[model samples]
Target: MWRELALGLAGPLSPMRQAQPVGFRAGQAVTQREWRAEVAGWAAHFAAQPGADVALYFEDSLRAAAALFGAWHAGKTVWWPGDALPATAERLAAQGTHFAGDWPGGACARVAPQPEPEPEPEWQPLDAQAPALVVFTSGSTGEPVAITKRLHQLFDEVRALETCFGSRLEGARVVGTVSHQHIYGLLFRLLWPLAAGRPLVAERQAYLEDLTRLDARLALVASPAHLKRLDLPDLAGLPVRLAAVFSSGGPLPDDALAPCAEGLGQTPIEVYGSSETGGVAWRQRAPGADAQHPWRALPGVDWRIEDEQLALRSPQLGSLDWFLAADRVRAEGPGFVLLGRADRIVKIEEKRVSLAAIEQALLALGGVQELRLPLLPGRRQELGVVLVPTAEAWEAIETQGRAAWLAPRKRALEPLLEATVRPRRWRLVSELPVNAQGKTTQAALAALFDPMRPSARLLQREAQRACWAIEVEARHPGFDGHFPGHPVLPGVVQLDWAERFGREAFAHLQPAFAGLDQLKFQQVIPPGACVELELQCDEAGCVLRFVLRSARGPHASGKLRFAAAGEGA
Candidate 1:
């Protein structure tokens, strides 16, 4: 192979040339080819520039990949700000040389328009150790760390794809649902397809319904977050033949795996890897499969356990030969079983507790659709659980006779209600806050119990003509027992007040108490602290709003909802 820098190199011909009909809008398809040509032109433009770094902000996956490759061909480095938040972008820009993307009002220089150029010859290879890309990982301590990947590391990763799965992806069109900015998306969707001589799908399938309209035997590159959204009523009959389903980002729960197998006629192959190590291991969701221990390391990747955590050394890491990960894994003969992340464990009452374990336990309970465990900040060890009940679970909890439908732990924990976090604080929510990749952010988890950030939308609001005002002192009698002297108002009581106000505002609305939506206890409101109550209602339902302020500081503010008795009642 020759080595040089030039964009738009024609891929090597592969024997498998099945004209796989990919599903994409005509405009998008045309734009993909156009974007490729434009990227080649941009590569030439960048070749004339001094620095070797470029920032990309394009939303379209194909366009982003084209820009990324074009920069690489010009011997430039790609800097991807995965979060894309203003603070994150500023930090990246400070260290980066040039930036590209559609972000509005940022300090980075705008990407210049591409100029037309004559068709370039095939791309020549550059030094394998040449810097190719920079990806930022969320630091264990909440800061971000920039990890660089070399050309050779990227090539090795793409080469390992064949060994990771039994099938050859030659000539296979790749359509990814995950963002190209992330490691999983970058490797599976762009590099692997390019190395295998496959044409990449320019558009991302945002919804499961979009799959039905697609024309190719899709490889459905997805994350556990996307897989959870799929509600397959009957899996035995579907038109599409999925070559394979790949899941990463987080663990694919056993419950999610079963439906994917029955519906798609193929078990989802879970991938275990991180931003640092690239691709590591693979496992299939088969009957009696061990989720914790089924992972087999990819060929050419060396693995070992150190202090209960898994570490990997691979040819793909360039100068960095070894990378230690936070995943807790135990040896299983030739392979390993992944226990949750090492950071996920918390200590309570001198006993070690796994929030992930508690979440899995709560998810196993009947009527629970989704659950999240968030730790409260205080002297006492408090675990807060936010839950969204299935309709059946909702009915069972609301009707006293139906309470038997719950498991013992769920029943015991349900009464701690919306406000207090004791053995557990259970707050019912319409839906959990999951990010684009389907992973829940710690910020989002903390927001759940935060009474300050209520999830309910105010549909309608009307001040009472004859306002019935009440000033109530906030107090949690159990707080003394919870910590003995450092008492704080329970989150459930704050939610309860909101519900009571809902009943008061919509007197004619017949507030059918559905369940607690969501609640958060930001700063504790102490006993004897006066809280002002406000109430409102509309055609959709009612809302109870509370603003609690004390001489110390702003205590908490929140809203609650009561579903209307009927559709238009």
Candidate 2:
């Protein structure tokens, strides 16, 4: 019956007399009647431009849903970009496409939900097999892949999800930390709840502090990246209690899961799937459940281990053909245990190296909070590592020097991994680089190794002021690939150097960074240019002002804000 309703196979719609609440916007209820009316308004608005493909980008789920359904009603398809960043806009422009979002690019006229919907717009059923949505992969492993979904495939997957977990979530209000643009968010946060008659919260809960406002029963649709940062103290006395929490996008480490279950009311149900495959398998580790719990395949999803890779055939695919996944797994009893991805294995010096195995080994080391291991460019087969040290490890480095801090940890890994597989170069950073999707990309990972972009020299020091002379050369990383014929230091590199120097010279800004503000770039510094860096720490020690100047004029200036020791953004 759910599948029939989802696939528009349930018969003609009857007029609903009373307004059923669909969601909340700014603490105000949005009714089913209003939503349908909005959909109708959008349909009429787009009908004039029928058969046009639209790139949709809405941060609000309710408005996004109205636009999506309206587009389908008008016989049009919707495209989703990986993000709304400038780079994504450039990519879309390269493809000669226009977008309909809250962004600035005026390639297409923006369509928003009507402030007040029209009265009594007629309802209509959509063609079940028409192409509906285009979703892009996270691009964590490689370039993002675009996958198109027919209405049947998407609706069938929603039905399957409801059948598997809907009973436990009945009557639960929907809340999310993840963005509605991704597949998990599209299904769980919007479509599933809409079909289940559950109301959605308008605002996205980005910070742990945001969860404190929940006062009702909730079905949280979230990702591991967000869940790992849960703060127990901040979540206390919330107006809302969680009935179920759903996590996806990446593996939920045991370290994060235990705390989440203890802090929240229930253990999270982690969904294992990708953009191409909707909801494949799920697992929830009870307080006393086995440490090596396997993920059970969803209802109607048939799976098999083919050449160590997981393969599936389900109605969600709109056919009986098996779809192969990159994940390697082993069948255990009625389910399967995922053994990393086959693509993570790389060759170094003609020797096979398992990047996953090395990472897992490194994670087992004490004082390592988070880390990423990627192979270096060229045929040398060497590896590069970006590591985020735990507070304890960072303290050790501050007190004992970097070599003393790294010696024992490196020795511990020596017994577990081969020399060829060990990372040759490592970078320590305050946090990992993540995109809007909370997934780190290969490009972001490689950018951590940017070679000595700026050389710094301490010129003078005083009680509250410090001065440094910096030099940028042609071989600097900031200049490479910035432009074909011309090269200049990027503003981000300048800010990074300022922050690094500020931390070294001032004791107050140590530990964590809050944010940067009041940034202005007046001039571009070319190669082989020498510049002066001036920094001042206020009496309160929470703010630092930095300025970069050359013989001509100021290159850049910004104010760096710091949160004391444990407090940070």
Candidate 3:
């Protein structure tokens, strides 16, 4: 099977050739033959708009893969944004691009996979070197960067993956918890399985509960973000057992892998690579493996340590030259042990960001004197900046207030950084947290962002409900919006606080708001009042009900409904 598959990987592309089930949608099998017909139909439509640049966004993996192949066949360059957020679409739309999938901005054209009844076109091989994809990265240094790829670049990585793990994943159906828009999911979830003749689950399995519905012979393509949250006991009741599991996009902690081993009967095959340098190395931890376990380089990948950083030479780069990576590693037992990062750049929300560049930008600003930008803990995907403000800025905060003082500082950073990499929360401090050696440490900086150390304190907590006893400071900026003479907490601020508390208390709550219902602000919550803010989550109805009360009685009460993240506002 491996030899036959290897020959197929090297053979001419046949889009309409049927070998395995491509996907299952609505209890209907989407065979490779039917998928190819849809691709050909969309290709003919796209071929009409020759030379057009199209931005593709799809919630469905099968449709996304079809559009990708269809656009490439039509000789159109496909732009893949990480998300379909309006801001992202608007920014790329300014470059005169057409939109596809369910994106709701602009007058751009949309394409759907509609398999026509016409004759199935003969399979045609694609140009190996043709520019097919343009993937945007949160710039490692400053602004966002675009990485272009030809068909061969992606195919090289896919071939490498199949060559490495094809036999073990034999007859396994592909099911992913990651999005197909990014490189990791694009290769593992869609491209690799498609090329290797494996069936796939069409919709992304967002919740762990959904995985219980899956049948047998499953191969899970997931990310560290999803795997880190999985508890061993939660996976005990899974209907089907996974044969092979793949993880990427970041380091998968040992704890996350333990559950995969216990639940799936296999250690996760963690692939270490990036969009630019695909599948550099892989490692499957043996039982009792320690942090010092080395990563084995993939076939056709040549790796060397360059100035303490990991550098690779592979066909995945579309060239023979070595591409230096941000990771630092040292040789250990025919593989390499990963050290910490050599650069000050990090990935938040799978988007690359340069901490050094952000620090430099902030130091250049008039108000910021010294600062440290630390990636927030868990999957929040945000940066919390701790700053020792300039004397002038501190004075302004005292006189002009925090909301007014912090507004311009963030606005000043707009020209230098993308919104994805921007620091969302700003903390003002008199001094920096440092070690005995006087170096600002990550742990020290992270401690400053703890909500417990801040104004909010958890008074009582339960599974779905938490009561916070908050004393709103008189000088707090949130009071600026309500009347100046009789300062009261605004309805908007109350709702925002409710949502924030709900997220902090209930870690599994989706952060997206679906709707607001029966909101009543009966009394004014004045500054300096000690109020009890209670949050109750309705998981069945997908609603979060909140009430703010004090001795003065119900200040505010409302129900804020939230959909799963990415279901739109």
Candidate 4:
């Protein structure tokens, strides 16, 4: 692998060397030689610190590569913590010793950058099975799981790349908009180009305008998140040869694929794999291609079905045979079709329903850009959907009764019926929150739907100020043991709920809270408490008076105040 990279760098016969790949920015281009020098210098510096796990967090590709190679040459495991939250970083730091990519405030030795040499050494062969890269998987609930792969596994992934895209990528300059930390970015942006003896563009282009200034025939490695932002009409006139456009992280919405293909003149090649099993399959989003097939394993890799889930054993990871995956797949002649994750499927009222399937169906609807379907805890008959609607569609849904819009099963139900297992709450949104990989978190989805705790209270504007009432409700069935035995709603959850209610009430204003005064919890409101909340607004923000009421009487009561951040237009 290293040898090919070196040849691509120095060999006169190498296509990459002859082409002199350039990193295009606002209006300027940086040559491959300059990029190599910067990275080599960082490698030399990183080599000074032996055995220290280094975190590479640069936003720029050239800098990121330099930090990565530097740590690699130092023989230290490099941790690409992608866009992990601060809490995640603290958790990782607690688990192992780490050197930050950015300079520390108080450090001992400062390694100086070295000059580029005239003759580069021949690339040395790397042990295929030796641990080389560590990427993280966003765990289902809490901490992210760190998965390690050997150099050979990466090589196998590159081999898969050749089979899937060899025809299109010959002598193509590789440019990427995805982060180099994740598997998708690691394989497409760094390893694939290095293995194929192709020069990679050192900058990460975020906007379509930035990509347009570059030379044509470029292989763009991007994610569905990045691609979704592109305006097809703007990209249509650019000189993009578009050897291939690769997307991963999540299923690329079909609506996005058609226009992007029409604009770029090439169908996007989507890769399906995870942190545990490197590269699994590749499929082009052509007109009639099966949207559900598992990627054909590379030449040497073997695949089989274990308990309805796909299992793979590759020569890349020696001694490790049959790594089980979460994806559910069925045989399709030479290949297999993916049927979503087995874990993502939930059983509601004896009916098996896949949240991913429901979300896909909702996305297929007109003006629905993105949607999330999460089963509310303890509610066997209830489901919640957070949807982002187009401006026109948003108006239509608001004007047309929300219940009227649903055909039958898609609508909410009052009394739990045998056949009424559809989503109960449908929250309209301008945009959905997505993680770095473009996947939404359960917590984020819950925030969109529930917004506030039952104990919290806020003021709402009615037609007149003649009436005031304390409304309290417990809708979350999971609220029972959000804590152990002394289950009281979390403070942050209460604050989130208040903010959500305020945002809805004062849609035109950005509401802020000065403070909560005389906040008292009178009683324990268990899960499933139907509560009512009333709010009164004055110059000193809005005051919330809430009561968690049951069928008999009030279960709990509380007051909250929300101050407007600043004067609004």
Candidate 5:
């Protein structure tokens, strides 16, 4: 049964029986009645809260879904922030929104379980025009901006989804790697499933091995970031059969299309839109198709082009007036071809340049796995490329110096881009620096060239180990008061970084520091020098090994022992 978004929690979306599976968590089923009772519990608790706006963050989609509907049922507008970072917390607090659901810093009012909710009259359906949600953009271009969505708009979007793609996903369990905090994830991973009576998987698949372990009929809700990593040769195909696969948050790279076909058993339907626009269109690539295919408009969504920028008028836009989008497009037969983003065009040295074109050229070189070319300001504005290289390119860069591998790529791009718009600064990385939504922000991208602080960026990460490439800027505080004219990195700072990384990699263990063995500082690590810190798990139950090295040699290497069961050291 496909329930309308207007019906929401009050409507009978699923059988309200004790055994009806509402969601799946770690392979266990959560009952529909159990979830309903939790939603009622949240509503009761929210009735006592003074504020009408709640900022929510939860890694588990089902629990977050309960909190969302509960607040809405209580006449509150829920704000979905992609992260609970300090900056986001401050912003929410500034807006007088109460923190809720898995937010850190003890800022949230925890949701309580309702084993036996007091039987009362059924809840009334929410008003269709009332404000229901405020979602933040992914911050790919700049700081995140909030977009308010009304219940009527969301209800229409859900109905549209049910009308267009409902048949293929009948009774499919929704599985996802993306967090529900983002708009795309919130729709496909949580809301759509509940509206259509499909089960949702609670925990995200952090590693491909975890997804491979599942034996269920599933519909994957994924982003380009996660889908691009699934191209592996050791695995022939995923054992778990998928009913459907959906991709958004960016275009699925042409290279990743085959992996989805191989591992997922179906060509993924790519949904195109933004937080502000909801969903405007979707398209799936047919086998053997090589050219960029035009995207068909979503149900009840109408599109037009004026001055090369695409504009839309649909129920999803929340108005009849056309909402102009940032993307430039060309009309094709019964569809449109996306040219690039008109908003990303930047002016450099009295010359106009398309940052999207520059980015496309870098991506076309084939070495780049992911990248962001943002305009950096100075006396002369220049571009900086924060790039994550592919596995093949990474191996070559590690063996041959980065300059050797990057030289030919730069030579190839010299013809594709204007010299004035060429990236002046480069930060080669293993992973893109992004928020929980996998959108790289302007500040994070610019941090690579920041001279005031020491930054640790990921170079590579594996099951047993994690490696970070740290750049100690010339004016880093680690240099202060070390020597009159000469400055060296302190041993304490190096140890601190190693310990911090271990904490992240082994967070589940809650490992407590006990003692250290094999500690050695071989060479003086000077300021303004770059180094690599590698943290690895030792086979012994409680030992963690680390190495701090540079081009010169190993600066330090040691093994750290943590407290074991009932043992101090």
Candidate 6:
């Protein structure tokens, strides 16, 4: 195979015939020739536009790739925002960028299917020094910041990826659960496959079962959060072993690694880098591996310790100068074991505390399944923990109360954590909120403490339905004036909640309220009670059915009717 086909990027991706099938667009095979014509058409269209910078957003990876390369081919710089949300579009438009591909703002340009080139369609070589992309940080730390990447940086990283893992993934079909809007998804799902001549499945996989249903010779680009909750039952009926599996955002959790490797018949390559670092190092969890398993650097990447921090100089940085990273590491033979982030340290009452240490201490508890510590800002800053409790603990919480659930766990942490730095507020949730990048940002973690939002955690979701875990505390606003001493969830509040959660679970709900039928308040839901709210949408009849139940008994159940579209306000 040629160098470009085997381990190169950008110059001539996949040294193969244009007529060969490059990928699948929504399960339909698209030849490289057709893709070239699309790119050419997009290039011509954008080339005639005025601005040098344009904001691009697309749910379809092929369309995204076409627009990306087309924008570059047209000598235009691209601002790759993390989502197609209205706010994101407005922000990009404020920067004076023309919107392209599925954005809600302006007259967003859509890709023209079966576009014809004025002349013969051809792939043009992109300049290595060109300003290629401006991507945002995952906002895991704080507010998201913008980082620009030169064409050479992308070219270098893809080549590095090919050099590192090309052999194992040769001729594989790339599929992913992560969106292409994010940097990790863009690289692993689209760019890497393009460079390797691998076929890419356009649509993002929703359920874990969706990934397993595909045919042989597959490479799945996934996130750690997605893999951690992997139920082994979902892996059943898989016909063949995947060629490779790549995880970004963070290292795969210890429990998740074994099942993935054993079940998939391949060790998942966990890339340890962020949007800022690009691809720094990668490692696979071996049998009985712990923190002892170190991350090895990619080709052409150099790493060194500077003041107990990991410093790197990668081609992805587009600079030869060593860039110091915030993460602290203990050097192994040639690789390094990540200790924790140095910036996660906080001070309380003249005492320094490692927030990461506090998290580790809580995670060690059997009752806590997953948790995130969000720094609650006030006159005096304090730490608040959002916990997704274990099944047994949640059962106890549901029966006893949220306070009852948190009391013993907080007591258990007394030995491992300092009193000053311990979590001041505890919020039980079903899952951590994640952004489009499959990462939980600082803002998201903090939002759990918001009083206005429903104190409910969505436990399960299916088409036209969702299950939420609701905890009504003694001090709940709904219990304020409902006959003080005998405070119970009000019937009117139950009706209001049904409508609110109903709209959230079912997207097809009309804006206007019509009426209700078969509404019943069976039992009194006392204060400090935990319950499950099941909302099922009957789209055909425009009725939303809700059932609120717990271990005690059924509290409320109702069928809510809604007006059709434009029927009422």
Cα lDDT tens digits for candidate 4, 431-540: 66454456667766776555343322122355211111222334454355567754555544544454555443433323655556655555555544444443333434
Clashes of each: 16, 5, 0, 21, 0, 0
Per-residue lDDT for 1-569 in model 1, tens only? 11111123545323232223222333234333354465666677677767768777666666576677778778888887654556556676687567666665755434445665655436665556777788876544434568888878877877787666637343345776777777888888767765555566767767655666666666778876667667676333442557778888776656666667667666677887877788888888684454664688888889899989998888876644567877888898899998767676543432234455456545655567777777765444477766777767656654653224444756543432212223544455545655546667766666655543332312234543112222232333424454457566676666665654354344444456554333445577655554444454544555444554445555556555455566222
Off by over 4 Å in 3: 1-20, 50-52, 109-116, 237-240, 349-351, 356-366, 376-382, 390-392, 403-425, 431-439, 450-569
Tell me the TM-score of each prediction against the true structure.
0.59, 0.60, 0.71, 0.58, 0.62, 0.62
Better of 1 and 2 by lDDT: 2
C-alpha lDDT of residue 421 in model 2: 53
TM-score of 5: 0.62
The lDDT values for all models are 0.61, 0.73, 0.75, 0.59, 0.75, 0.75
Given candidate 3, what's the lDDT at residue 75? 77
Against the true structure, candidate 3 reaches a TM-score of 0.71
> Between the candidate structures 2 and 3, which one is better when assessed by lDDT?
3
Q: After superposition, how far is residue 144 of candidate 1 from its true place, in Å?
A: 0.4
- Candidate 1 Cα misplacement greater than 4 A, ranges: 1-36, 48-50, 106-114, 166-171, 233-240, 287-290, 344-569
Model 6 lDDT tens row, 376-420: 865445788888888787788768977776777788556444465
The number of clashing residue pairs in model 4 is 21
lDDT of 5 by residue, 319-370 (tens): 9999989889999999998887767545454233556556665777788878
Error of 6 at 460 (Å): 42
Candidate 6: the clashing residue pairs are none
Candidate that beats the other on TM-score, 2 or 6, i.e. the better one = 6
Could you tell me how far off, in angstroms, the CA of residue 142 lies in candidate 5 after the best superposition?
Answer: 5.0
lDDT string, candidate 3, 1-569, tens digits? 22222232223335544644678875468876677776776687677763478888888888887887788777788898877766577678787876777687545445555764765665456777877888976555655678888878888888888888989887778889988888888888888877777878888988655776776578888877677677566676552467778888877776666666666667778888887787888998865676678899999999898888888999879888888887888988888998977666687655566676667667766677778888777655688977777777767876886678778778766654557667887777655655446677777777666643334545678777878767677766777757869897777777878876676566567657788899999988787887889999865537889999988889999898877778737
lDDT string for model 2 (1-569, tens) is 35423643224334662366788887788876676677766766667663467677787888888777777777777787545656456555565544676655565545554645334544556777877788765333333456888888877788788889989886778999887887888889878887777898867777755766766778888876667677788778542477789988776666766678767766789998877888899999876565368999988899999999999998777678899887889999999998876666454442334565566666777778888886666424368877778878777876886668677667655643446456667766556655546667777677666575354445677757988777676788777787768888888888888876675566555467888889999998998888999999886677889999999999999898887778888
Query: Which ten residues in a row are the worst by lDDT in model 4?
Result: 463-472
Model 4 scores what on Cα lDDT?
0.59
